[model samples]
Target chain A: MQIIIVVLLSILTILIIGLLLWKWRVRRQFRKEEQKRRLRELELTAIRSQMNPHFLFNSLNSVQNLVQQNKGREAHLYLSDFAGLIRKVLNNSEKEEVSLAEELELIRQYLNLEKLRFDFEFEVLVDETIDAHNTQVPSLLLQPFVENAIVHGLQNKRGEKHLKIDVMKKDAFVLITITDNGIGRKAAKEIQQQKNGKGTKLMKERLNILQQKQGEKYKLTTTDLEEGTLVEIVLPEEK
Target chain B: MQIKSIIVDDEKHGRENLAGLLESHCPEVILVGLANSVKSAIQLIKNEKPQLVFLDIEMPGENGFQLLEHFADINFEVIFVTAYDNYAIKAIRFSAADYILKPINFNELKTAVEKVTKRIQKKEENRQIRELNRNILQPDNPRIGLPTNDRIEFVEVKKIVHCKGESNYTHIYLHEKKHLLVAKTLVEFEDLLKEYSFVRTHKSHLVNLKHVVAYSKTDGGTLELSNSDKIFISRRRKDEVLQMLKTSIA
Candidate 1:
């Protein structure tokens, strides 16, 4: 009976040891996942930070050009609006995600800022069917796409320059389309091949991080259409 | 009490925001003509002869520092505006220069305006030698100035080794034996040195190209100074520094 008791005790000890090892393995996995999340957050923040200054520098250049040409009053109005918009961006940087309504407001502000630089040449279209309040997006996500449209698409185009932005919801996903009547596919391919433009490269990086964090829930793509170029972003509806 | 001011920025918004702030807070500021580019700023300086300028550090083709290069003579005070925080800002502060961060804070704006006012007031009492010395430094130039215990010394283009930002003061290492302490911060020195051959290798260190003895590829990278000091190059600046080094060597 004593021998039987000893064997039972050994079996119990083995089970306990096995359980502890399993627990440790689970905890290690959890820690690694947390670390990855933190790294992604840092990268997203870095990308978002780059967007504002990039746009600011370019916009300021446009304003400077206008002022040198003696358009002081217009420059004043443009600057006032730009300041207001930038203040919004700075305030929003503290939050991880912003409401679709807030994002739209930011986009409107950005469009207005760009309007100052482009004068009457720049135009934006927002589809009224989409309810922006129900959705959420990464802050400053839409602006870069719009900016890319302007920089790569509309800036050097020969004919009428127009930027068309469409926001629509389908099932559980929110789709944002920005199309610019600028240069054709050849120019875009050429520009990308040059690898000199920092803006396009930055935009891709931000989109990649957004996809990684959300886990294949966000899709961003660029395609050259007959009118100009089409840039589309589809994001999952926040639960 | 009239602060003679000119707007020196390429952005319409930057110029307007500054103008708006001056109009609202410092009403005594005489609105001088605005300049968009370095060339224009130079022309405006010659023509308008404004005593103060609201300058933006970055422009499209030529940045604000290049504006100083255009002028053989300078007789003005500058308040820099920038969107991003960089080592350059520390350099500018180290030089006793005034600058405001973008999305301009009202309180900071008020302080900068006040500082410009005080400088204008003190300008008359300062000696001609000091004025000439400053002219040699160029009022609109963004090069870092070293400040000693008693007086602020403007560093000539080639004599600087590197600058390390230590708390409130910037420790400027010179090619010569005597290192100086600038009352300004590192961010200020960075701004002042934006146009020079200096680049921020690390958050705390800004190195002059003339003093980089050798560069060693390690963790991120490392630069060996003339004094055999190993300065760690930041990952963000590695590509930029390498490109700059290549150009300089070429």
Candidate 2:
């Protein structure tokens, strides 16, 4: 009986050591994987942060011009509003996803800045069925397309410029459409000197990365209208 | 004395906006004519012989800059009006010419007009306009104007080594161990030099990537410039600085 007991105690010790070794190996692998994921996140953030350089600087210039004009009250208001937008962008930098409501607020703020430069009418509509506060979408997914509509379509247009955004619920996906009444893509291309569409390309790459990482369905389509262009983005309800 | 001026912009709103501002704030600027295109602007300039021309740089057929090519000698003062044009703005700044960004700020318009009025009174020649044309034609070798205490100094961008920011002023270090103290802020310099391979390694330091010889990883990180000067890499900017260096070198 004593010999049997001693043999059982030895077997139990060996099993515990083996289990501990396995746990340590698994933990090390997990840590390495976590590190890799963080690096990739950092890279995505870099790509996402490529906001329009022209808009950024031009907005600052507008502020400076206002101050120099001695419109102290107007300058103060413009600067504060601009600062708030910047803060929102910075706050969302680390986040992979944000509520649809927050995203719309950001877009509204951005449009306000553009309004300072161009006279345009803008409107945003949300479907009654969709809850923007609860719906999760990829952060800054639609900015590039909206910017393209303004810069390429409306910038050189002759008459009144109009921009509209519509959000609706469609099956398992959320549909967002951006419509602009400005010069068509073909005309814009003819005028611009081969300035490649780097922003659009970067945005497409980001969308692909997000889709792959999150295992979600994402769709984008652009239609050139007779007067302007329309961009539609369909994203999964849950990111 | 009224300073006769012409407004030339393709956009209707732009023309009306500037016209209204001039009518309201600038009583000294008498509007003689308005042109929608460079072709019309040339005709107006010859017919009116205005003392000032508020020119829009980007138009459909011919840009505002091309209008200058039509004249052998620019007699009237030109103040470029544009919403945004990076290359054109740089050339304008380099030539020490006057420019105002749109959504026309009344104060900026008044200031630009005031300066032009002074120049008109002094009968100063428009040498800067000629310089601007030269810079536009030869964009490969761009120069930057640094304002000193008394006068402005124009230097080729490639010759500058680095810059140090102190309070509001900046000390510009150039090649051959020469440096100049300018009245401009480091932020302004950074904006101008950013596209020209200048990187801000720290809040107080902006360095030319071309002048960097080596980067050391010891004690966080440090950069050894071609001038044998050491610049520290801030903890926050270490990753970005390395990334910029990699792209610049490759």
Candidate 3:
């Protein structure tokens, strides 16, 4: 009986030791995978900074339109703002994360140039509850969604168009809601002569890649509102 | 083990009728206690900590919603019994709660009982598991692994606001205001999410009851969500919508 008891105790100790070793191996594998994912995200982030030539041509055409129409002063201001936004975008592509304030300012510059070209109304509302300085977001994350909101959601609408963006923190996630009171998805689809031509497919792919980086926590939901489209991006709160 | 439940109604007949129905019909519910007022009901609940409560909306001193306000972190399922007119019913439907009206039909009672049986037990277990601390970034709900097309996303059930049927595809809208167009049909999703707060608001639409903001009576009632999105409510489902609204509260 004494020999049997000692044998059983040794077996239990061996099982526990084996379990600990297995757990350590699994944890190391996970860490390695996480490192690999971060590297991939970094590479994608750099490649995404390449500006589309069509957008450049469109902006240039607008500038030419302004120059031909002899709106010299306005054209000059538009050119400078466009230049400033591109410079900022290029600079930001080198960083992993930027202050929320800096990111929003970049977005503002982009919107300003777009507004000068399109003459549309827009609003940016950072919630009072949020500490703008403390919150850090990955650069260029919000640009694609904002561009989609402007180009697809609001471009075709008649009368006064409004685009509103709200940034609020929910638990450990930063929820960014972009609302555009313009023609909705069904209407936009009806008018689309080209299939996913206007960077929407690219936007979707970028979002998917971003979602992969955050695993399941990252969520991007687009709901068709009563009069327009509401795109919500929930990203992990990284400071 | 059977789940402990309480019946709360001002009328003795009402309480007894519900208790009798449970005794005869619902084998899953172990009727532990009964109460007639919000005051006594609170005491009973505090002591018993029952998993389910069959509450009447029109109590003498305080209504059902007021009773709910007394407690934070309501850990039990509540199925309200109400004598409804038009406005109150609309409000109940707007909230996406579960309820059975006075002169409750046999079928409605049976279905409500079955629904409560399935959900309340799951709630208790889920609640206990949810209380455990998880990785900070992960939401505190069971992750649903959805494999659609090339990508397999493990999404939290709570984040899914609604799923709409578009021909052969299902468009799942999340809390983050993201729409995922999946190749699977709505029926497949409905089957997977049968245990959740999703309800068939329309044949083409299945909405999460928790995300429902209001029910607009205009154009024969429409469902408004928190995201300012609107969905149509079929005429046949007006009552079912009300019941769903009530069950959603827990």
**TM-score of every model versus the real structure:** 0.43, 0.53, 0.40
Candidate 1 — which residues are off by over 4 angstroms?
Answer: A1-54, A115-123, A191-193, A196-216, B1-250
* B1-250: candidate 1 lDDT, tens digit per residue: 8877899889898889778877886788888799888888887888888888788888888877567656555567777788764554544554456788777766678898886687678773212223333544664543434547755566665677888876557777877555887765565565456467787776567888778889898866899888667788765456668988787777
Model 1 docking category: incorrect
Cα lDDT tens digits, model 2, B134-247, are 777887887777877855677888888899876557899988899899877675687678888998776578899999999999777899998888988766457668999999
lDDT of each: 0.69, 0.80, 0.70
lDDT score, residue A96, model 3?
Answer: 48
Sort all candidates by lDDT, best to worst: 2, 3, 1
User: Per-residue error at B10 for model 3, in Å?
Assistant: 92
TM-score-based ranking, best first? Answer: 2, 1, 3
Model 3 ranges off by over 4 Å = A1-50, A169-173, A193-216, A235-239, B1-250
Model 3, position A15: C-alpha lDDT score: 100
RMSD in Å for model 2: 16.9
Per-prediction DockQ comes to 0.03, 0.03, 0.01
Error of 2 at A38 (Å): 9.1
